[model samples]
Target: MSPTTRVLNASTKALYRLCLLLPLLANHEASAEPLVIELHIPDAPPLTFVNDPRGHGIVGDVAVAAMTRAGYTVKIHVLPWARAQKHVSEEHDHLITPLSRIPTREDRFTWIASIMPMERAFFSLERRVSSFAQAKETYRKIGVGLGSAQEDILRSEGFSDEQIYPLAIGDNPAQMLLMGRIDAWFNGVPESRYIWPKVSKRKLLMSSVGSNADLYLACSKQCSPEMVEHLRDAVEALRADGTVKRVHDLYLPQ
Candidate 1:
């Protein structure tokens, strides 16, 4: 073969090899570029907590795992429940996890996935009440976290403004119940169970007031539908692979 022809053939072979590697290089770069997502979580323990040195709890772990599997990098911000909801609602591309799926909040944000079922109930000193109706008759003041789903549920149940006691941020209603400031405390079962032992040693009575509601990952309206579906599918994959249950078991009360 002529010298020029040999050189041209060698160059063509090298160019073909480079072309084969280009797609792989592009794919690696795309995979390395993780989609950064902002997550807002509440301090509700056993389900979610910020006190841990790692800044995560059960739901936090589950959320991080799911988002990671969905090809995104997660940035978790622990905030008060009200503030978390507000941030997710007002900010673009923000998400809040483990929020109750209620009618009042259905249209406020894009629902991503159902994380777990939450039981809404009223907690009082043992023997104080057997049922919600009895509790309403026995307790004049019902304590609830201010602007919480518990408060909204109570109102929907026909609780008057005079009968409802809204507790400030970081306030524990179980302590208020023990202190006799309120006759009954309203909150989710998981949160109430986690807080009861921390606040008081007294036995408490629990009466379910509302149906079990599924907690969800809610994103800002500005979030695209494709992103929401991606998260939903991620959660489903986690659940199917037992990742969700494994994470929940790690933080569950033993």
Candidate 2:
């Protein structure tokens, strides 16, 4: 009836609406700020790089995209291959990318998604070995990434540690081969090809595939179930939507 009463009633209604929206606004703010996750990667090129301004690499790009899609703000750490693996293994809920999914590593990390196929081979400057056995016999010293699946595969195949020259990833294994420090370099086929041109002009003789595996976006055993599920679903969607293939083609164009 009175102007003051009408104004009071309108204010009360407005206050009620504001109160109702407070809880929703809080929830929205909480979701707007994404969960921060640490992502570790090795320096292997065309797969994951340490200092590249454009991006990490093929699989690295995929991992970042998946994590972003899963509502995570990724904090990337570029470490040595072995150190990255150890960091992820020891740190709770931390993630590592392009890790080979092997039997020995199956239980060490919680697998999120398979990023790409990992096909390993031996590359030599002067020789073309057909098989692992031939490589073991023909090469006096074989260069393998330290603490990499390639090293484990070599050891499992009966190649003694004395014959295996373990080098850190991104330490220029191709240079070691070119300098005659190692007779051959054994690593992922894509990585070897990607690095050979960067380090040398000579032709690299590649051997047949030494092993087959899939590189995965994996996390520590203590990773949360929700995180795993979200990342897994994001990766699957990326795969389905051709985002993963597009990222791969950036480095390994066919």
Candidate 3:
């Protein structure tokens, strides 16, 4: 072969290799960048507290730890319970924390792992009922979180619209109960107990277990499987290492 032709052939081969190498380099750069994940939570106490400096709340603290362990940057959004749920449901790769895993929500999102167990009950200042049936007949206006799993549970159990006073997730239920706006407050037991003391020094009576569920760290239906697996593994590790319980204890009274 002529020297010029040989030089051109070598140059052509070098350029072709460079073309193949460029994409790999680009992919490496992309992979090296930390993935940013959105974490949404309600202003529910013991689960999340909007702007609590002490790591947000129990589930919030655990979520941050898990996300950090999964090698991702988490951006937390404190939204109303209903709005947060709707947005997470519509968006891709978004996460909602402390979401109760119920039959109605089984297909709405991808359940990553259980963050905590949810045992719901009714709390009253003056009224007490032995069973749901009795409570339904006894209480005229029961307070519940707006668009929460508790509301869904009540509706499913035949609670009429007029009977349920849906309040935004917060300490308002305790205040409402004290003000005589709601005859009873139906919510997660931990949340109720946590708020009752903050709002009033008075004691409240709790009814029998109203609903049972597991609160989960869930992603949107269109979430990335790789991300899901990373978070799932991180959360499982935290649970196994006693980190979850440790975080939970921080919010509960000693």
Query: Which stretches of model 1 miss by more than 4 angstroms?
Result: 1-32, 53-55, 168-171
Q: Write the per-residue lDDT of candidate 2 for residues 1-254, one digit (tens) a residue.
A: 99999999999999999999999999999989988999998888899977788688999999999999988999998787788888789889999998998877888899999999989998898989999889888999999888899888888899988899998787567889989999999899988887888887899898888899999999998899999999999999999999999988988899
Q: Residue 140 error for model 3, in Å?
A: 0.6
Question: lDDT tens digits, residues 1-254, model 3?
Answer: 99999999999999999999999999999999988899998888888868777877888888889899999998989787888888898899999988998877888898998889989999998988877899899999999988799888888889899999998888888899999988999999898888898898888999998788988999998899998999999999999999999899999957
Report lDDT (Cα) of residue 132, candidate 2. 80
lDDT of 1 by residue, 1-254 (tens): 99999999999999999999999999999878988999888767777776787447677777877788888889888676777787788778888877788888888888889988888777888545556677667778999887678787877878889889988533478778899988888888777887787787778888755557888888997887878888889999989999878777777745
User: What is residue 245's positional error in candidate 2, in angstroms?
Assistant: 1.1
Off by over 4 Å in 2: 1-28
TM-score for predicted model 2 compared with the true structure: 0.88
User: How do the predictions measure up, each by TM-score?
Assistant: 0.82, 0.88, 0.90
